[model samples]
Target: MLRITAGKLANALRGTVSGTSRVAAVRCLHGTEESAEEFDKRYEKYFSREGIDGWEIRKGMNDLLGMDLVPSPKIIEAGLRAARRVNDIALAIRWLEGCKDKCGDHQATLYPFLLEKISPTLKELGVPTIEELGYDKPELALKSVYDL
Candidate 1:
């Protein structure tokens, strides 16, 4: 049996790997990074479009929340409004939770800022936050049998 350290393997393959990565990197860079404001506007426009259905709303939210960065308050506001227009109260609430989670370590500041900015829309749309509805904890979180 033969075992090669990753360092030795990389040194052996570096020439080919580096050559391939350069072309791949150039192709990847074809898409430019959008500004935060542009990002917010793009998503806001997506959710505010006419005839947007519940499935589309959920898909858009999934894509936005799945991004590396948390969405802006305006984008969230627009999404919640779309969910309300589609008559999906649960989706609205869940997106709120999703935004909160995306706050990452900045929750102390970012989440509250989001709530404050989006509160008026929340009230207008009749959507209560997950915390306000007291559902952050699992309803069936019982003690494990082994714990006894």
Candidate 2:
């Protein structure tokens, strides 16, 4: 009969693998610590390829927003523009909502700024404009867009 305890097996496996491999340190940037140039590089590296559509943009933004990181207004604007290019404004709005919920004032401030930037495009798409919705607050404006 062979009897091997879990501890003995773990110790044997540990001995077989070397712990000398260097593990890269992960640095997380928040607030203004991350620069616009760095954000541009990341966006270009991931989504600047030809034939990249809304699905890819949404997926990429989802991954970026999933991280415990806060992006600058320029980065968020770039993401919105990418979404608009693929006619995924709804998804972009949802992403901004999620960011507003998670990041509070910083994202809240950006929501309206982005809405203004995209309002003309949204009107062209037959979606209700922010002014037409009679909502000055970004949160309400977003809700109106969702309802459409």
Candidate 3:
């Protein structure tokens, strides 16, 4: 369950190894032929002050979707955390929407917990709950896979 991107993993390894060594380690560990220069550039951007933002998380999720990979709860959670860290409610809800749409019934088990995590932010922003967003049922707000 290596849920994070290679660049993130590489950046984490930087505490133990130099950046160049980390890049080499990642390359060797993953058996990737990507050039050191490319990895360096990618990691530099990835480890910047902003780190990985919600947009990048969305793009990564989209890339996985484009590859026909169904997102697991961990993937969805990562995107949600990124969206929340960036204070992007629209992106948070977009990830929620993706969970509903792409994850089907499997998403139900996570909704209550996810809602608990995001509810404060929603409240702070004065955003309406899914029920107020035109959903007819409370359970549907947590468990429904279809958009309201």
- Give me the candidate number with maximum lDDT: 1
Q: Model 3, stretches more than 4 Å misplaced? A: 1-50, 104-132, 135-148
Candidate 2: worst-modelled 10 consecutive residues by lDDT: 20-29
- Which 10-residue window of candidate 1 scores lowest in summed lDDT? 21-30
lDDT of 3 by residue, 31-66 (tens): 666764554444334423267766676676565444
Q: After superposition, how far is residue 67 of candidate 1 from its true place, in Å?
A: 0.6
* TM-score per model over all chains: 0.72, 0.48, 0.40
Backbone clashes (count) for model 3: 0
Off by over 4 Å in 1: 1-30, 140-148
Q: For each candidate, what is the lDDT?
A: 0.85, 0.60, 0.57
Please say which candidate is ahead in lDDT: 1 or 3. Answer: 1
Clashes of each: 0, 0, 0
| lDDT, candidate 1, 34-144, per-residue tens | 566766788899999999999999999998776666888899999999999999999999999999999999998988888999899999999998878988878889988
Instruction: Please give, for residues 14-73, the per-residue lDDT of candidate 2 as tens digits.
Output: 787653321111122333344547755776566655678887887877866765556555
